[model samples]
Target: MGSSVAGLIGWRRATRICKTFLFSLILTTASGAVAQADCRADQVELRWPGGQARFSVELADDEAERARGLMHRETMPRSAGMLFAYETPRRAQFWMKNTLIPLDMIFADQQGVVTRVHSNAIPQDTTVIDGGDGVQFVLEINGGLAKRLGITAGAELRHPKIASSLWACDVE
Candidate 1:
Protein backbone atom coordinates (compact mmCIF):
# COMPACT_ATOMS: atom_id res chain seq x y z
CA MET A 1 0.00 0.00 0.00
CA GLY A 2 2.83 2.38 0.89
CA SER A 3 4.69 1.73 -2.41
CA SER A 4 1.51 2.23 -4.41
CA VAL A 5 0.86 5.48 -2.54
CA ALA A 6 4.40 6.66 -3.32
CA GLY A 7 3.88 5.79 -7.00
CA LEU A 8 0.65 7.81 -7.05
CA ILE A 9 2.41 10.83 -5.55
CA GLY A 10 5.20 10.60 -8.14
CA TRP A 11 2.65 10.48 -10.95
CA ARG A 12 0.88 13.50 -9.55
CA ARG A 13 4.18 15.45 -9.36
CA ALA A 14 5.02 14.57 -12.97
CA THR A 15 1.58 15.69 -14.09
CA ARG A 16 1.95 19.00 -12.33
CA ILE A 17 5.28 19.65 -13.99
CA CYS A 18 3.84 18.86 -17.38
CA LYS A 19 0.94 21.19 -16.82
CA THR A 20 3.24 24.04 -15.81
CA PHE A 21 5.41 23.57 -18.89
CA LEU A 22 2.38 23.52 -21.16
CA PHE A 23 1.01 26.69 -19.60
CA SER A 24 4.29 28.51 -20.01
CA LEU A 25 4.55 27.47 -23.65
CA ILE A 26 1.06 28.71 -24.37
CA LEU A 27 1.71 32.03 -22.69
CA THR A 28 4.90 32.56 -24.66
CA THR A 29 3.14 31.80 -27.93
CA ALA A 30 0.30 34.16 -27.12
CA SER A 31 2.73 36.94 -26.30
CA GLY A 32 4.49 36.49 -29.62
CA ALA A 33 1.21 36.56 -31.49
CA VAL A 34 0.18 39.72 -29.73
CA ALA A 35 3.45 41.35 -30.67
CA GLN A 36 2.99 40.49 -34.33
CA ALA A 37 -0.60 41.65 -34.38
CA ASP A 38 -0.06 44.91 -32.51
CA CYS A 39 2.99 46.17 -34.37
CA ARG A 40 1.30 48.39 -36.92
CA ALA A 41 3.05 48.66 -40.27
CA ASP A 42 2.38 52.40 -40.56
CA GLN A 43 3.86 53.43 -37.25
CA VAL A 44 7.32 53.91 -35.77
CA GLU A 45 8.10 54.94 -32.24
CA LEU A 46 11.17 56.58 -30.78
CA ARG A 47 12.20 56.94 -27.17
CA TRP A 48 14.82 59.35 -25.92
CA PRO A 49 15.99 60.46 -22.50
CA GLY A 50 13.50 63.28 -22.19
CA GLY A 51 10.48 61.85 -23.95
CA GLN A 52 9.06 59.74 -26.75
CA ALA A 53 7.52 60.35 -30.17
CA ARG A 54 5.45 58.41 -32.64
CA PHE A 55 5.21 58.88 -36.40
CA SER A 56 2.86 57.61 -39.05
CA VAL A 57 5.40 56.15 -41.44
CA GLU A 58 5.46 55.10 -45.05
CA LEU A 59 7.96 52.30 -45.58
CA ALA A 60 10.54 52.50 -48.34
CA ASP A 61 11.60 48.90 -48.05
CA ASP A 62 12.51 48.14 -51.64
CA GLU A 63 15.02 49.60 -54.05
CA ALA A 64 12.44 51.48 -56.08
CA GLU A 65 10.54 52.73 -53.09
CA ARG A 66 13.71 53.90 -51.35
CA ALA A 67 14.99 55.65 -54.45
CA ARG A 68 11.73 57.47 -55.02
CA GLY A 69 11.34 58.57 -51.40
CA LEU A 70 9.42 61.77 -50.81
CA MET A 71 10.62 63.24 -54.06
CA HIS A 72 7.44 64.96 -55.12
CA ARG A 73 5.34 65.27 -52.00
CA GLU A 74 4.60 68.95 -51.49
CA THR A 75 3.09 68.75 -48.07
CA MET A 76 3.39 66.15 -45.32
CA PRO A 77 1.60 65.98 -42.02
CA ARG A 78 3.56 67.10 -38.98
CA SER A 79 3.45 63.62 -37.47
CA ALA A 80 4.03 61.79 -40.74
CA GLY A 81 7.35 60.37 -41.95
CA MET A 82 9.10 57.86 -44.16
CA LEU A 83 11.15 54.92 -42.94
CA PHE A 84 13.87 53.31 -45.03
CA ALA A 85 14.77 49.79 -43.96
CA TYR A 86 17.92 48.41 -45.48
CA GLU A 87 18.65 44.78 -46.07
CA THR A 88 21.82 45.12 -44.03
CA PRO A 89 23.71 47.75 -42.08
CA ARG A 90 26.03 49.87 -44.18
CA ARG A 91 27.24 53.41 -44.74
CA ALA A 92 24.22 55.54 -45.65
CA GLN A 93 24.40 58.65 -47.78
CA PHE A 94 21.34 60.62 -48.82
CA TRP A 95 20.78 63.59 -51.05
CA MET A 96 17.95 66.10 -51.32
CA LYS A 97 18.09 65.69 -55.15
CA ASN A 98 14.39 65.69 -56.04
CA THR A 99 12.88 65.74 -52.56
CA LEU A 100 10.44 68.62 -52.45
CA ILE A 101 10.15 69.32 -48.75
CA PRO A 102 12.79 70.08 -46.17
CA LEU A 103 13.50 67.09 -44.00
CA ASP A 104 15.25 65.92 -40.86
CA MET A 105 16.98 62.61 -41.32
CA ILE A 106 17.38 60.31 -38.34
CA PHE A 107 19.82 57.49 -38.90
CA ALA A 108 19.78 54.37 -36.76
CA ASP A 109 21.91 51.29 -36.43
CA GLN A 110 20.96 47.62 -36.68
CA GLN A 111 20.05 47.61 -33.00
CA GLY A 112 17.58 50.44 -33.70
CA VAL A 113 19.61 53.00 -31.78
CA VAL A 114 20.02 56.46 -33.27
CA THR A 115 23.49 57.14 -34.62
CA ARG A 116 23.19 60.46 -36.39
CA VAL A 117 20.74 63.25 -37.21
CA HIS A 118 20.90 65.64 -40.10
CA SER A 119 18.50 68.51 -39.58
CA ASN A 120 16.65 70.78 -42.00
CA ALA A 121 18.06 69.45 -45.21
CA ILE A 122 17.32 72.00 -47.90
CA PRO A 123 14.83 71.02 -50.58
CA GLN A 124 16.43 69.73 -53.81
CA ASP A 125 19.89 70.70 -52.60
CA THR A 126 21.61 67.57 -53.98
CA THR A 127 24.22 67.58 -51.24
CA VAL A 128 25.25 64.25 -49.79
CA ILE A 129 24.23 63.91 -46.16
CA ASP A 130 26.35 61.12 -44.80
CA GLY A 131 24.96 58.97 -42.01
CA GLY A 132 28.34 57.27 -41.41
CA ASP A 133 28.60 53.49 -41.16
CA GLY A 134 26.46 50.67 -39.81
CA VAL A 135 23.23 52.46 -40.60
CA GLN A 136 20.38 50.03 -40.95
CA PHE A 137 17.50 52.48 -40.94
CA VAL A 138 16.84 56.07 -41.96
CA LEU A 139 13.78 58.10 -41.03
CA GLU A 140 12.79 61.29 -42.84
CA ILE A 141 10.43 63.69 -41.16
CA ASN A 142 9.51 67.35 -41.47
CA GLY A 143 12.45 69.69 -40.92
CA GLY A 144 13.38 70.55 -37.33
CA LEU A 145 11.10 67.90 -35.88
CA ALA A 146 14.04 65.98 -34.48
CA LYS A 147 15.29 69.06 -32.67
CA ARG A 148 11.83 69.91 -31.42
CA LEU A 149 11.26 66.39 -30.11
CA GLY A 150 14.79 66.09 -28.61
CA ILE A 151 15.55 62.93 -30.53
CA THR A 152 19.24 62.32 -30.89
CA ALA A 153 22.02 59.79 -30.58
CA GLY A 154 21.17 56.86 -28.28
CA ALA A 155 17.46 57.24 -28.91
CA GLU A 156 15.79 53.86 -29.25
CA LEU A 157 13.66 53.22 -32.35
CA ARG A 158 10.90 50.63 -32.39
CA HIS A 159 9.40 49.14 -35.54
CA PRO A 160 8.61 45.62 -36.58
CA LYS A 161 11.04 45.78 -39.49
CA ILE A 162 13.85 46.33 -37.01
CA ALA A 163 13.70 42.60 -36.20
CA SER A 164 16.15 42.69 -33.27
CA SER A 165 16.45 46.07 -31.59
CA LEU A 166 17.06 47.98 -28.36
CA TRP A 167 13.30 48.53 -28.16
CA ALA A 168 10.98 46.10 -29.92
CA CYS A 169 7.24 45.69 -30.34
CA ASP A 170 7.30 42.53 -28.26
CA VAL A 171 8.60 44.43 -25.24
CA GLU A 172 5.82 47.03 -25.11
Candidate 2:
Protein backbone atom coordinates (compact mmCIF):
# COMPACT_ATOMS: atom_id res chain seq x y z
CA MET A 1 0.00 0.00 0.00
CA GLY A 2 2.82 2.41 0.87
CA SER A 3 4.61 1.69 -2.42
CA SER A 4 1.42 2.40 -4.37
CA VAL A 5 1.00 5.71 -2.53
CA ALA A 6 4.64 6.71 -3.33
CA GLY A 7 4.08 5.89 -7.02
CA LEU A 8 1.01 8.11 -7.15
CA ILE A 9 2.93 10.96 -5.55
CA GLY A 10 5.78 10.55 -8.00
CA TRP A 11 3.38 10.59 -10.95
CA ARG A 12 1.72 13.72 -9.66
CA ARG A 13 5.12 15.42 -9.29
CA ALA A 14 6.10 14.39 -12.78
CA THR A 15 2.85 15.75 -14.22
CA ARG A 16 3.38 19.03 -12.41
CA ILE A 17 6.89 19.32 -13.79
CA CYS A 18 5.66 18.69 -17.32
CA LYS A 19 2.97 21.33 -16.96
CA THR A 20 5.55 23.82 -15.71
CA PHE A 21 7.84 23.16 -18.65
CA LEU A 22 5.01 23.55 -21.16
CA PHE A 23 3.98 26.82 -19.60
CA SER A 24 7.54 28.10 -19.82
CA LEU A 25 7.72 27.22 -23.50
CA ILE A 26 4.55 29.13 -24.24
CA LEU A 27 5.75 32.17 -22.34
CA THR A 28 9.10 32.14 -24.13
CA THR A 29 7.45 32.07 -27.54
CA ALA A 30 5.11 34.91 -26.65
CA SER A 31 8.01 36.99 -25.37
CA GLY A 32 9.95 36.46 -28.57
CA ALA A 33 6.99 37.52 -30.71
CA VAL A 34 6.54 40.70 -28.72
CA ALA A 35 10.21 41.55 -28.97
CA GLN A 36 10.26 41.15 -32.74
CA ALA A 37 7.23 43.39 -33.13
CA ASP A 38 8.81 46.06 -30.97
CA CYS A 39 12.16 46.01 -32.71
CA ARG A 40 10.59 46.82 -36.08
CA ALA A 41 8.13 49.41 -34.88
CA ASP A 42 10.00 52.64 -35.66
CA GLN A 43 9.54 53.82 -39.23
CA VAL A 44 11.99 55.33 -41.74
CA GLU A 45 11.00 57.10 -44.91
CA LEU A 46 12.46 56.69 -48.42
CA ARG A 47 11.78 57.60 -52.02
CA TRP A 48 11.32 55.16 -54.86
CA PRO A 49 10.24 55.59 -58.46
CA GLY A 50 6.67 54.74 -57.53
CA GLY A 51 6.54 57.30 -54.73
CA GLN A 52 7.74 58.04 -51.22
CA ALA A 53 7.49 55.12 -48.78
CA ARG A 54 8.10 54.34 -45.16
CA PHE A 55 9.96 51.38 -43.67
CA SER A 56 10.82 49.98 -40.30
CA VAL A 57 14.54 50.39 -40.70
CA GLU A 58 16.74 48.18 -38.63
CA LEU A 59 19.52 50.73 -38.47
CA ALA A 60 22.96 49.17 -38.12
CA ASP A 61 25.42 51.70 -36.76
CA ASP A 62 27.30 49.07 -34.79
CA GLU A 63 28.27 45.40 -34.88
CA ALA A 64 25.38 44.05 -32.84
CA GLU A 65 22.61 45.66 -34.93
CA ARG A 66 24.40 44.76 -38.15
CA ALA A 67 24.73 41.12 -37.06
CA ARG A 68 21.09 40.85 -36.12
CA GLY A 69 19.73 42.69 -39.20
CA LEU A 70 16.21 41.47 -40.04
CA MET A 71 16.61 37.83 -38.98
CA HIS A 72 13.58 35.66 -38.14
CA ARG A 73 10.96 38.10 -39.44
CA GLU A 74 7.88 36.25 -40.70
CA THR A 75 6.69 39.14 -42.85
CA MET A 76 7.95 42.52 -44.00
CA PRO A 77 5.61 45.32 -45.02
CA ARG A 78 5.72 46.21 -48.71
CA SER A 79 7.07 49.65 -47.92
CA ALA A 80 9.32 48.55 -45.12
CA GLY A 81 13.06 47.78 -44.88
CA MET A 82 16.15 47.71 -42.71
CA LEU A 83 18.63 50.49 -43.45
CA PHE A 84 22.26 49.90 -42.59
CA ALA A 85 23.99 53.27 -42.22
CA TYR A 86 27.73 53.64 -41.91
CA GLU A 87 29.92 56.67 -41.32
CA THR A 88 31.64 55.95 -44.63
CA PRO A 89 31.22 53.68 -47.61
CA ARG A 90 32.85 50.27 -47.29
CA ARG A 91 32.49 46.90 -48.91
CA ALA A 92 29.55 45.16 -47.22
CA GLN A 93 27.98 41.75 -47.57
CA PHE A 94 24.66 40.33 -46.38
CA TRP A 95 22.95 36.99 -45.91
CA MET A 96 19.43 35.88 -45.08
CA LYS A 97 18.66 33.40 -42.28
CA ASN A 98 15.28 32.76 -40.69
CA THR A 99 14.06 35.68 -42.81
CA LEU A 100 10.78 34.41 -44.21
CA ILE A 101 10.36 36.88 -47.10
CA PRO A 102 12.72 37.52 -49.99
CA LEU A 103 14.24 41.01 -50.37
CA ASP A 104 15.96 43.47 -52.69
CA MET A 105 19.07 44.99 -51.21
CA ILE A 106 19.92 48.54 -52.35
CA PHE A 107 23.37 49.82 -51.63
CA ALA A 108 23.94 53.60 -51.56
CA ASP A 109 27.05 55.68 -51.63
CA GLN A 110 27.88 58.45 -49.15
CA GLN A 111 26.05 60.88 -51.41
CA GLY A 112 22.95 58.63 -51.10
CA VAL A 113 23.00 57.59 -54.75
CA VAL A 114 22.08 53.96 -55.29
CA THR A 115 25.35 52.11 -55.93
CA ARG A 116 24.18 48.52 -56.33
CA VAL A 117 21.10 46.36 -56.15
CA HIS A 118 20.68 42.69 -55.22
CA SER A 119 17.19 41.53 -56.05
CA ASN A 120 15.21 38.54 -54.76
CA ALA A 121 17.36 37.33 -51.92
CA ILE A 122 15.98 33.88 -51.11
CA PRO A 123 14.65 33.35 -47.62
CA GLN A 124 16.77 31.32 -45.18
CA ASP A 125 19.69 31.53 -47.60
CA THR A 126 23.19 31.74 -46.13
CA THR A 127 24.85 32.71 -49.37
CA VAL A 128 27.19 35.67 -49.02
CA ILE A 129 25.44 38.29 -51.20
CA ASP A 130 27.88 41.01 -52.12
CA GLY A 131 27.40 44.79 -52.34
CA GLY A 132 30.51 45.68 -54.27
CA ASP A 133 32.59 48.91 -54.23
CA GLY A 134 31.41 49.80 -50.68
CA VAL A 135 28.48 51.99 -49.61
CA GLN A 136 27.43 54.21 -46.76
CA PHE A 137 23.83 52.98 -46.70
CA VAL A 138 22.13 49.67 -47.49
CA LEU A 139 18.35 49.32 -47.79
CA GLU A 140 16.60 45.96 -47.79
CA ILE A 141 13.16 45.96 -49.37
CA ASN A 142 10.58 43.41 -50.48
CA GLY A 143 11.96 41.28 -53.31
CA GLY A 144 11.42 42.64 -56.84
CA LEU A 145 10.15 45.96 -55.54
CA ALA A 146 13.34 47.65 -56.64
CA LYS A 147 12.85 46.59 -60.24
CA ARG A 148 9.10 47.14 -60.21
CA LEU A 149 9.51 50.69 -58.93
CA GLY A 150 12.49 51.38 -61.18
CA ILE A 151 14.69 52.15 -58.21
CA THR A 152 18.06 51.48 -59.76
CA ALA A 153 21.65 52.62 -59.56
CA GLY A 154 22.09 56.42 -59.36
CA ALA A 155 18.65 56.91 -57.76
CA GLU A 156 19.11 59.48 -55.02
CA LEU A 157 17.84 59.28 -51.45
CA ARG A 158 16.21 62.43 -50.04
CA HIS A 159 16.65 61.74 -46.36
CA PRO A 160 17.64 64.92 -44.60
CA LYS A 161 20.24 63.09 -42.59
CA ILE A 162 22.06 62.29 -45.80
CA ALA A 163 21.71 65.83 -47.09
CA SER A 164 24.52 68.26 -46.47
CA SER A 165 24.06 71.59 -44.60
CA LEU A 166 21.20 70.32 -42.42
CA TRP A 167 21.27 71.09 -38.70
CA ALA A 168 22.70 68.13 -36.84
CA CYS A 169 19.85 67.66 -34.34
CA ASP A 170 17.12 68.73 -36.77
CA VAL A 171 18.13 66.33 -39.53
CA GLU A 172 15.95 63.28 -39.81
Candidate 3:
Protein backbone atom coordinates (compact mmCIF):
# COMPACT_ATOMS: atom_id res chain seq x y z
CA MET A 1 0.00 0.00 0.00
CA GLY A 2 2.87 2.43 0.85
CA SER A 3 4.68 1.77 -2.47
CA SER A 4 1.44 2.22 -4.44
CA VAL A 5 0.70 5.52 -2.71
CA ALA A 6 4.24 6.85 -3.47
CA GLY A 7 3.83 5.99 -7.16
CA LEU A 8 0.54 7.88 -7.33
CA ILE A 9 2.08 10.97 -5.77
CA GLY A 10 4.96 10.89 -8.25
CA TRP A 11 2.54 10.64 -11.17
CA ARG A 12 0.57 13.62 -9.93
CA ARG A 13 3.73 15.66 -9.60
CA ALA A 14 4.71 14.84 -13.20
CA THR A 15 1.30 15.85 -14.46
CA ARG A 16 1.50 19.19 -12.69
CA ILE A 17 4.91 19.89 -14.20
CA CYS A 18 3.64 19.08 -17.67
CA LYS A 19 0.67 21.40 -17.32
CA THR A 20 2.88 24.26 -16.12
CA PHE A 21 5.27 23.78 -19.01
CA LEU A 22 2.46 23.83 -21.57
CA PHE A 23 0.92 26.94 -20.04
CA SER A 24 4.25 28.78 -20.16
CA LEU A 25 4.72 27.87 -23.80
CA ILE A 26 1.26 29.11 -24.67
CA LEU A 27 1.69 32.38 -22.78
CA THR A 28 5.04 33.05 -24.46
CA THR A 29 3.64 32.43 -27.91
CA ALA A 30 0.62 34.66 -27.26
CA SER A 31 2.77 37.56 -26.08
CA GLY A 32 5.00 37.30 -29.13
CA ALA A 33 2.00 37.42 -31.47
CA VAL A 34 0.63 40.47 -29.71
CA ALA A 35 3.96 42.29 -29.98
CA GLN A 36 4.11 41.68 -33.73
CA ALA A 37 0.59 42.99 -34.24
CA ASP A 38 1.33 46.25 -32.39
CA CYS A 39 4.50 47.11 -34.32
CA ARG A 40 2.81 49.01 -37.16
CA ALA A 41 0.86 52.24 -36.76
CA ASP A 42 -2.84 51.89 -37.61
CA GLN A 43 -3.71 55.51 -38.53
CA VAL A 44 -2.33 59.03 -38.41
CA GLU A 45 -3.92 62.40 -39.03
CA LEU A 46 -1.81 64.91 -40.98
CA ARG A 47 -2.42 68.50 -41.98
CA TRP A 48 -2.36 69.06 -45.73
CA PRO A 49 -3.25 71.83 -48.15
CA GLY A 50 -6.94 70.98 -48.18
CA GLY A 51 -7.25 70.67 -44.42
CA GLN A 52 -6.58 68.10 -41.75
CA ALA A 53 -6.49 64.83 -43.69
CA ARG A 54 -6.43 61.65 -41.66
CA PHE A 55 -4.22 58.90 -43.13
CA SER A 56 -3.61 55.28 -42.48
CA VAL A 57 0.11 56.00 -42.53
CA GLU A 58 2.93 53.64 -41.91
CA LEU A 59 5.68 55.42 -40.05
CA ALA A 60 9.11 54.81 -41.60
CA ASP A 61 11.53 55.97 -38.96
CA ASP A 62 13.97 53.07 -39.17
CA GLU A 63 15.77 51.05 -41.84
CA ALA A 64 13.14 48.30 -41.87
CA GLU A 65 10.16 50.56 -42.59
CA ARG A 66 12.19 52.62 -45.06
CA ALA A 67 13.07 49.53 -47.08
CA ARG A 68 9.47 48.30 -47.16
CA GLY A 69 7.96 51.64 -48.23
CA LEU A 70 4.65 51.06 -50.03
CA MET A 71 5.75 47.87 -51.72
CA HIS A 72 3.30 45.05 -52.55
CA ARG A 73 0.24 47.02 -51.49
CA GLU A 74 -2.50 46.98 -54.17
CA THR A 75 -3.94 50.36 -53.15
CA MET A 76 -3.48 53.20 -50.71
CA PRO A 77 -6.36 55.22 -49.32
CA ARG A 78 -6.70 58.78 -50.70
CA SER A 79 -6.64 60.40 -47.24
CA ALA A 80 -3.65 58.32 -46.19
CA GLY A 81 0.03 59.24 -46.42
CA MET A 82 3.20 57.67 -45.10
CA LEU A 83 5.25 60.02 -42.97
CA PHE A 84 9.01 59.36 -42.90
CA ALA A 85 10.69 61.22 -40.07
CA TYR A 86 14.46 61.49 -40.22
CA GLU A 87 17.07 62.53 -37.70
CA THR A 88 17.98 65.74 -39.47
CA PRO A 89 17.03 67.83 -42.49
CA ARG A 90 18.98 66.84 -45.59
CA ARG A 91 18.53 66.18 -49.28
CA ALA A 92 16.41 63.00 -49.38
CA GLN A 93 15.80 60.92 -52.48
CA PHE A 94 13.33 58.13 -53.14
CA TRP A 95 12.68 55.61 -55.93
CA MET A 96 9.72 53.39 -56.76
CA LYS A 97 11.27 49.95 -57.05
CA ASN A 98 8.88 47.06 -56.40
CA THR A 99 6.23 49.60 -55.42
CA LEU A 100 2.80 48.50 -56.63
CA ILE A 101 0.99 51.84 -56.48
CA PRO A 102 1.90 55.27 -57.83
CA LEU A 103 2.60 57.96 -55.22
CA ASP A 104 3.24 61.67 -54.85
CA MET A 105 6.19 62.39 -52.58
CA ILE A 106 5.72 65.56 -50.59
CA PHE A 107 8.97 66.70 -49.02
CA ALA A 108 8.87 69.16 -46.19
CA ASP A 109 11.25 71.10 -43.98
CA GLN A 110 11.75 70.58 -40.26
CA GLN A 111 8.91 73.01 -39.68
CA GLY A 112 6.65 71.00 -42.06
CA VAL A 113 6.49 73.41 -45.05
CA VAL A 114 6.59 71.48 -48.31
CA THR A 115 10.04 71.91 -49.80
CA ARG A 116 9.57 69.68 -52.86
CA VAL A 117 7.05 67.41 -54.51
CA HIS A 118 7.73 64.36 -56.68
CA SER A 119 4.47 63.36 -58.32
CA ASN A 120 3.48 60.14 -60.02
CA ALA A 121 6.49 58.11 -59.05
CA ILE A 122 6.78 55.28 -61.54
CA PRO A 123 6.84 51.82 -60.08
CA GLN A 124 9.93 49.63 -60.69
CA ASP A 125 11.91 52.70 -61.71
CA THR A 126 15.32 53.09 -60.07
CA THR A 127 15.62 56.73 -61.08
CA VAL A 128 16.20 58.89 -58.03
CA ILE A 129 13.53 61.48 -57.23
CA ASP A 130 15.25 64.27 -55.36
CA GLY A 131 13.59 66.02 -52.43
CA GLY A 132 15.87 69.01 -52.47
CA ASP A 133 17.93 70.52 -49.63
CA GLY A 134 16.70 70.75 -46.02
CA VAL A 135 14.00 68.12 -46.31
CA GLN A 136 13.19 66.61 -42.90
CA PHE A 137 9.95 64.79 -43.58
CA VAL A 138 8.55 62.98 -46.65
CA LEU A 139 4.82 62.31 -46.98
CA GLU A 140 3.75 59.83 -49.68
CA ILE A 141 0.26 60.32 -51.07
CA ASN A 142 -1.70 59.33 -54.19
CA GLY A 143 -0.19 60.22 -57.58
CA GLY A 144 -0.84 63.62 -59.23
CA LEU A 145 -2.81 64.82 -56.22
CA ALA A 146 0.03 67.05 -55.17
CA LYS A 147 -0.14 68.94 -58.43
CA ARG A 148 -3.93 69.07 -58.48
CA LEU A 149 -4.11 70.40 -54.95
CA GLY A 150 -1.10 72.70 -55.42
CA ILE A 151 0.70 70.84 -52.65
CA THR A 152 4.10 72.06 -53.67
CA ALA A 153 7.05 73.62 -51.90
CA GLY A 154 5.92 75.72 -48.96
CA ALA A 155 2.93 73.61 -48.02
CA GLU A 156 2.82 73.26 -44.24
CA LEU A 157 2.17 69.98 -42.45
CA ARG A 158 0.45 69.59 -39.08
CA HIS A 159 0.88 66.29 -37.34
CA PRO A 160 0.72 66.66 -33.56
CA LYS A 161 3.56 64.27 -32.94
CA ILE A 162 5.60 65.51 -35.90
CA ALA A 163 5.01 69.18 -35.20
CA SER A 164 5.85 68.76 -31.54
CA SER A 165 8.91 66.60 -32.14
CA LEU A 166 10.51 68.82 -34.83
CA TRP A 167 9.36 72.20 -33.61
CA ALA A 168 10.57 74.68 -30.97
CA CYS A 169 8.14 73.13 -28.52
CA ASP A 170 10.50 70.20 -28.22
CA VAL A 171 13.55 72.31 -27.42
CA GLU A 172 14.98 71.95 -23.91
Best model number under lDDT: 1
Q: For candidate 2, what is the lDDT?
A: 0.68
Residues 1-172, candidate 1, lDDT per residue (tens digit)? 9999999999999998787556334323323342344567898877676566667899999999999999988999877899999999999999998888999999999988999999999999978999999999999999987886677999878788997645677746
Off by over 4 Å in 3: 1-52, 164-172
lDDT of 2 by residue, 30-52 (tens): 23332233212244444444344
TM-score, every prediction: 0.76, 0.64, 0.64
Ranking by lDDT: 1, 3, 2
lDDT of each: 0.84, 0.68, 0.68
In model 3, the worst 10-residue window by lDDT is 30-39
Best by TM-score: 1
What tens digits encode model 3's per-residue C-alpha lDDT throughout 1-172? 9999999999999998787556334323323342223223444333443433334577888878977888888888666778888878888989998888899998888887777788899977889999888888888988876665455665556554355433222222
RMSD to truth, every model: 19.1, 14.4, 17.8
